[model samples]
Target chain A: GIQVEQSPPDLILQEGANSTLRCNFSDSVNNLQWFHQNPWGQLINLFYIPSGTKQNGRLSATTVATERYSLLYISSSQTTDSGVYFCAVPGGAGANSKLTFGKGITLSVRP
Target chain B: DVKVTQSSRYLVKRTGEKVFLECVQDMDHENMFWYRQDPGLGLRLIYFSYDVKMKEKGDIPEGYSVSREKKERFSLILESASTNQTSMYLCASRVMGGGFPEAFFGQGTRLTVV
Candidate 1:
């Protein structure tokens, strides 16, 4: 089993601020994903980056698989960005690779 | 859009009652999973199915069981609910592939056992 840890357990930011969240895993992973759990408790897919970088609007993520770490960046944040951000990876190899999730970083973007 | 639907948004049940949480996916994904989320413990997998009639236990599957009678449906059954079982349950679906595709999740069912 792989262990995933997310940093900055809690964060508070004003609208228009920028912040970065990080996730570190204990072992090599074939899958890495970033998710946003909004206030309404819907887990929204942000990026499926096992390696390299990807951007979607104001959100972007980079995963350095070689380093076993990933970063999620939020720029010009808005109140709507307030919620918990999670990073996940499969537990191990083979057909039973169920995803294991980090505790998540709670972000509060105040207006 | 891809969607994983859970049957309930909130539920209240007695401690010894049997409880069933239903999940369905529209994308015809090969993998479906059930997870419970607590305040600080994050999302812990309870059970998962890679195909119809196939299932596997996850990290914390002690008091839970699952059934996958059809490809699109997966059900989590609590033999006898307990106060400790009260938490947010999430259902997710994903395609079976080497790359490990992103999983689509349901809005989550918040259950309380009294």
Candidate 2:
């Protein structure tokens, strides 16, 4: 079983600020995904970066597969960003690729 | 648009009741999964099916059973629902392809066993 660890379990930020959330995995991964669970409990896909870097609006993510670590960056965060950010990786490097998720980072953006 | 739809958004049942959670994906994905999320446990996989009539146990599969009779539908069944089973359940479906498969999730169903 591969372990996924997320840093800064709890986070609070003022609006218009910036933040970075990190995820580290115990073993190699075939895929890595970043998800945002909103207050309504809908998991929104943020990024599908197994490696390299990608940006979507104010949100960007980078996964260094060689280092077994990934970073999610939010720039000029707004109150809508208040929720839980979760990072999930494949449970194994094989073909099945069962996703194992971290405990998640709780983010609070004050308006 | 690609969507995964769960049968219910909220449910309440008594202990020992048989509960069924249904998930359907419009994308015709080959991989479907069921996961339960607790306060501190994140999202633990209960079961996943990669194809029709096939199933595999996940990290926390005790007391949970799944059925994938059709390619578009996957069901999670609880033989006898217990209080400990009360939590948010999420259903996801992913297209089986090369290296870039991304999972799409349903609006979670929050169930409580009384």
Candidate 3:
């Protein structure tokens, strides 16, 4: 089993501001993913970066697999970005690839 | 577009009652998963299936069971519900292979065991 810890449990930002969220894992992982739980409670897949970096519009993520850490970046934050961001890492192998998630970072973007 | 649909968005059950949560996917994915999300603990996997009739235990499977009778459907069952079982249940599906398989999730079912 792996332990995941997320930093800055809570964050508040004004419109057009930027922020970064981090996740650190205790063991090596073959999978790492970032998800955004919108106000409506829909878990949206933001990034699946096990390593390297990826960007999608205003959101980007980087995972340094060697260091067992990942970062999620939100640029020009908007009110719509206000929600909880979660980072997950899966351990074990084969069909039972279970994901262990962090406590999550709650973001509040004031308009 | 891939769609994961959960049978119920909200449900209430009495203690010791049997409960079933159904999930269906339209993309013909080879892998399906069930997870329960709780405060502070985030999401914990309950069970997952790789193929029809095949199942595996996850981190937290003590109170949950899953069934995949068909390729497109995965069901999570609670033999006897308890008050502690109250949480938001999410279903997800993903491909077996390829680079960084992204799991498409359902809208989630908020269950309360009273």
RMSD of each: 0.9, 1.0, 1.7
TM-score of chain B of 3: 0.97
lDDT, residue A71, candidate 2? 98
Best by DockQ: 1
lDDT (CA) per prediction = 0.94, 0.93, 0.89
Residues B1-114 of candidate 1: C-alpha lDDT, one tens digit per residue: 998999999999999999999999999999999999999999999999999999988889999999999999999999999999999999999988777888999999999999
Candidate 2 lDDT over residue span A1-111, tens digit each:
888999999999999999999999998886899999999898999999989999999999999999999999999999999999999987765555778899999999999
lDDT ranking from best candidate downward? 1, 2, 3
Of the candidates shown, which would achieve the greatest TM-score relative to the real structure?
Answer: 1
Query: Runs in model 2 with CA error above 4 Å?
Result: B98-100
DockQ (CA atoms), all models: 0.77, 0.67, 0.55
Candidate 1: list runs displaced more than 4 Å.
Answer: none
Candidate 3: tens digits of C-alpha lDDT, residues A1-111: 789999999999999999999999998877799999987677998998889999999999999989999999999999999999999877654444656789899999999
Q: Whose DockQ is higher: candidate 1's or candidate 3's?
A: 1
Give the higher-TM-score candidate: 2 or 3: 2
lDDT of 3: 0.89
Worst 10 residues of 3 chain B by lDDT: B94-103
Deviation from native of the Cα of residue B68 in model 3, angstroms: 1.0
i-RMSD of model 3 (Å, 1 decimal): 2.4
Instruction: Give fnat, all candidates.
Output: 0.72, 0.63, 0.53
